[model samples]
Target: MLQLKLYYHAKPYLPWRFRMATRRFFAKRKRIRYSGSWPIDPPSGAVPDDWRGWPNGADFAFVLSHDVETQIGYNKLDELLEVEKQLGFRSVINFIPEGEYSVSERRIQELIERGFEVGVHGLYHDGKLYNNRATFESRAKRINRYLKQWGATGFRSPLMHHRLDWLHSLDIAYDSSTFDTDPFEPQPDGLGTIFPLWVERKIANPESLTANQENQISDRRSAISGGKSKKPNGYVELPYTLPQDSTLFLLLRESSNAIWKEKTAWIARQGGMVFLNTHPDYMDFKGNGNASSFPISYYADFLQHVKESYGGQYWHATPDRVASYFVGCGDR
Candidate 1:
């Protein structure tokens, strides 16, 4: 913890090149160490117990989301939107409320008006939200305020750090801070399932909530089918099932989207959700290698592949609608 504190404290002073190189070194080691589990965790594909299956009998659910952490990323939203639009896809755009960049309500509304859902990323992109109970409680108030102000119903933590029980404080329909499997993250632990789980506010025992996700899911699932008690409400937890864009394009330096395509196919076969979280900050429309950005074509190609390979077989949805459907199904 001390090491992480020092690293984040000094992060502002370190050049991104130095940090990326340092991470790349460690990431490569982790990639080899966890090669069998990451990107494609076989057990994660298991359908949830008593699953009702996707809407309209679709093979799988698909959702795309982006986190804009800087002014540069915010500026590229339009270009990114156009690419997705051209491919007949829509996604959720999550903005940092108090990060290095400033986004106006008008801009957020513009995204909503353009057929995109808006969400609140962490208050700051810094990795401090879960530093301690007090810090999280304090920030939750502010985060909830932003969620209300922006009329957003989703929240994703920065760096994928999460405290599932702590998240119940926020006024949101769903939280996308967890992933199915990613050893590259600051919090290397994963939820171990591709399906979204309901984090019932009253049922989540403090002890289970702090444990690893497998145990957490076990305790929650037993409590799910029962009618929602007069117990306090809870929010849906959508664990992104695909590899993050930065982990693939920047840290691992992958040359193509083959990994994405391969994983998507597997998820489809298992009838699980193909939830993806990408960053516009690292998408290079210019095709220049600046800041280790990858060509936007990599993303566009993946979208095109989805369109061609699985046309009419998947339920393409925004994050909010996914959560709404899950809630309305009374499976919570």
Candidate 2:
């Protein structure tokens, strides 16, 4: 039925009706499985045995991210760097290659020199990457190539739009596109909470082009590692555990940083990862050409809170470092 529906939907683009008919004929044939489940392995990477030492021995990590668009001019970047320096925190900035604002190679290199991590934020800021496989793959490859040039190994699909099945093709070390939103989970039983999980792709056929190609992506859904324990995949999935700054400030009509502070404290206590997302276009003092006054003081004060509250124990690192450390790619 699934194949039949796919064929019907694709019929109009084919040159002949027989193409549809042929697909219909084969659609009824179900592939047999020797093993019901694919063989999956626990993450052999260096994951923390316990998450209790972060933020003053509380066992949580705060991953701050910025989605930088073209509209955000250089002035905003300068302000952001100042705020970061004041807080003693470094963040990952995901730059869209084809957006209202483009991040230059020099700027990206500068960020790296300053202990910040650069990441891919899609070729364009359009929200259509997850609509299909072909387009998504092409865009992913382009973004991946650019990231490699910039010395980045992580990705966050635009707007958090993701097709989990297609993510394996990107060749990124880790993905931060998953979230705990109630409406998005595939299975009825949620991943339970907004914790980071491993997303493993199961290659149903070793010989096919897509086989051994990371097809069956699963995370926090079942047991693995000889059934002694259940684990996510080799690819770490750092989900957005809290509302983005845009959602809180604009969508929720919030003018103060109180909401963010409250949520940060809550996630810290849970010993889980606190993934905070913001946009340079929104936070920029010059409005990044978007015309809104930059909230520099508010952002700085927020960072000050984290610095004072967490003290030196908080791992003030970038998202790339977090991903690398989680996957055992970098030194802890």
Candidate 3:
């Protein structure tokens, strides 16, 4: 954790090119070490024990999501949205509530109006939210406020740092902060399952409400007063099954999206979720900047592949819908 703090704290001081080169060097070593489990971990293909398959009899589920980290990334949302819209896909757009840029309510409403789900990425993109229990509890209040203001129920923490048990404080339907298998993140622990898992909220004392609970009491008096509200039903943990774009393009320096296609096929064969989390920050629509961006066509081509290769065989839903369905499916 201390190492993570130092890395994120010093991130601004380090040159972007230096960080990219350093990460690439370490990623090369990790690729060789975790070749068997990464990208397509055969062990992670096992379906949940009580799985009843996707709704509408679809063979598998596909979800798309993005974590906008900076102003540059936020500016590219329109372009990215157009690409997905043209491909007949929509995704959750998570924005940092108090990051380097300011997101207006108008933009949030526009995204919600366009069939894209809005979610709180984090208060800030820094890696300090989980430094300790007290810090998380404090920040969870602010995160919940943004969730309510944006009318969103999904969240994905910056840099994928997470503590699922502690996230119960936030008023979220699901969290995409974990992945099935990725040894490249600061917190590289994988849940080892491709399916969404139920994380029941902890029973809290009415007399001793946590920061988030106290903040929501006005809007949810009955639930907090007697602890009978369905909000306590807990949130879903949606771990991205596909390798991230930055991981493939920047760190590993892949020229194409073959790994995404290969892993999508494998997950589909296993009847698991083909959940993908990309970043608008790393997508190069201009077809340049290899240091931090990949050709946008790589993502476009992958979407087309999914549509053409397995048309009508997969259920494409947003992360929030997936969480609601999982909870409403009577599986819990």
Clashes of each: 0, 7, 0
lDDT of 1: 0.86
> What is the C-alpha local distance difference test score of candidate 3?
0.86
Which order, best to worst by TM-score? Answer: 3, 1, 2
Question: Which scores greater on lDDT, model 1 or model 3?
Answer: 3
Q: Highest lDDT: which candidate? A: 3
TM-score of each: 0.90, 0.69, 0.92
After the best TM-score superposition of candidate 2, give how far the Cα of residue 121 lies from its true spot, in angstroms. 0.3
lDDT of candidates 1 onward, in order = 0.86, 0.59, 0.86
List where candidate 1 sits over 4 angstroms from the true fold: 203-231
Model 3 misplacement above 4 A: 204-233
Better of 2 and 3 by TM-score: 3
lDDT of 2 by residue, 156-215 (tens): 876576666687766565678766542222211223344556566665653554433323
lDDT of 1 by residue, 1-332 (tens): 66767778899899989999999999989999998998899999887776788899999999999999888898898999999999889999998999888888898888889899999998888888888889988999999889878878889999898889889777777899999999999888899999888887765364554446444333333333233332235788999999999999899999999999999999999999999899988999886776569999999999999999999999999988887678767634
Candidate 3 per-residue C-alpha lDDT over 40-137 given as tens digits, one digit per residue, 9 for 90 to 100: 78888888778888999999999999999999998998999999999999999999999888989999999889999998998988788998999899
